[model samples]
Target: MALPESARLEGPILQELLALGGEERLRVLYRRLLAYFPHLDESERDCASARWRTLVQRAGARLVKKGELRREAGRWALTERGRQRAEAEKMLVEPPPEESPRRALSHEELQAMLVEIGRLLGKHAEREHERYDVVWKDSPLSPRLSHVFEVQVHGKLESALAKLKHAYDTQRSKPVLVVSDARDERRAREWLRPYFSGSFHEIG
Candidate 1:
């Protein structure tokens, strides 16, 4: 039930409703995806997203039937029961599985690749807690390996990039960045090109 990031969405409607604080216009909820993936071609992505409302309605109906939410004035809001349920579920669901680091890796084999890179470059990789996810200092990978590895690791990539830029500047490291697939990498490279003309690599 989770929507793919390439589809300009993140979901399981119940989870989204919870994030919206239990109330949101169906259309507004879908638009959250657009805000994150704004660069997605309208013809391709928007056309696909056009059906989200129907999906939301279908999912929300179940919640409404369970007394978890209420529909009024064409908007949906969480009922007290829903709020309580969401809190109860949060203990089991905080740090969602979809946001895990291995998401970009199509297969388990890639984890070994990341580890090999860290070993070859003499950098340490820690998937959790600390200023950045991975750190490389004074290694040959110095500027290249020194980065906040990309993922939809945060709720919003914009927030993540902001944190990355701040860390990059404050940490007195190299400058030059961004990437995912080739298309996304190109767009990000273009964005960073004016300020940095160094080697840039794309990692899923």
Candidate 2:
């Protein structure tokens, strides 16, 4: 079967979820799948779309046929063989950093810079907080957090964006992702394509 971009991504996504979570309901698994591949467009992102849903179902069906996965009653899971395959699959890991002539900021230093920027703006600034790497509040006395910052160094880009999205949804604070290099910035921008509504911002 011809696999489109969504189908291509769904195969590995389903395998990863099944290996990690065991049996998963299709709806919930699909939600996580969308999160993992944020470059998907509108029609592909719509869970209610039959065509999109079929792509996921087809991926599962192929895996089941390969004796790597099983599906029953709207739930999908990996077989023992599938678990091995998933474990064997090479992860999408970040490549080793190239040597730079200029000194680079450490992750903590990046967070500190964000906090310092907030302080200079006269906002209450803090770092290493739960939910965000750095946060800026309206004032020293006010409890309102006005901005949330996440610094991505060599960690999973999706995990960082997930936290930023959560912060935006819960507090309506402006979410910013700070990357260590231009390569990471490009990756972050590609992921934010799904957020055409402009829910996230990237800072170098």
Candidate 3:
């Protein structure tokens, strides 16, 4: 039987998991998707389960005996035949052509682009500052495409305190940053008094 369009997408999706070494990593990938796309209702998301089963069954039939794919633990890897078929399918696929590319810009042109971007950001910051006194800085965490986390620094204690409180209350996790100076840290602790009543540490 011919594979469905969903099955085709699922084949690559499962292959991506297998290439990452199976279920241990796959579960992490799944969770990251959930965290990033919170709009998805897990209970209503039958696509994942259905696609997973279809990919396993179809790919498994061509590679391993019936039931082999479903029986694996820790990692769900592709059988030899499955791997070959996946490779063949990938070879047959082609990406859509690029829409258009603006003429390559010179150094001066690039600098002009940067200036425009900075102006836009400045306008945005001014608008934001009018509504909220909080100022944010980037976190030390390395950006990962697969991670579902956002980290930021707040200039004032109240903003940081509010975020910290919300994180705990919502059962969500986020990293907050405070100044390295002892005096500033003390002040932050005092401001956070109402919301965060527990011990907090400052890391350089």
Better of 1 and 3 by lDDT: 1
The candidate scoring highest on lDDT is: 2
What candidate 3 gets wrong by more than 4 Å, as runs, is 1-6, 21-71, 93-204
**Per-residue error at 16 for model 3, in Å?**
1.2
lDDT of 3: 0.39
For residues 133-186, could you state the per-residue lDDT of candidate 1 as single tens digits?
Answer: 444444544444354543432255455455556655566444222243335766
lDDT of each: 0.52, 0.71, 0.39
Clashing pairs in 3: none
- The TM-score-based order of candidates, best leading, equals 2, 1, 3
RMSD score of candidate 3 (Å): 17.6
TM-score per prediction, in order, is: 0.35, 0.43, 0.26
Write model 2 residue lDDT over 52-145, tens digit each, in one string: 6777777777778889878889877878887777766636422234456877789989988888888888889999777689989898776666
**Lowest lDDT block of 10, candidate 2:** 90-99
Against the true structure, candidate 2 reaches a TM-score of 0.43
Candidate No. with top TM-score: 2
- Please tell me which model should have the higher lDDT, number 2 or number 3: 2
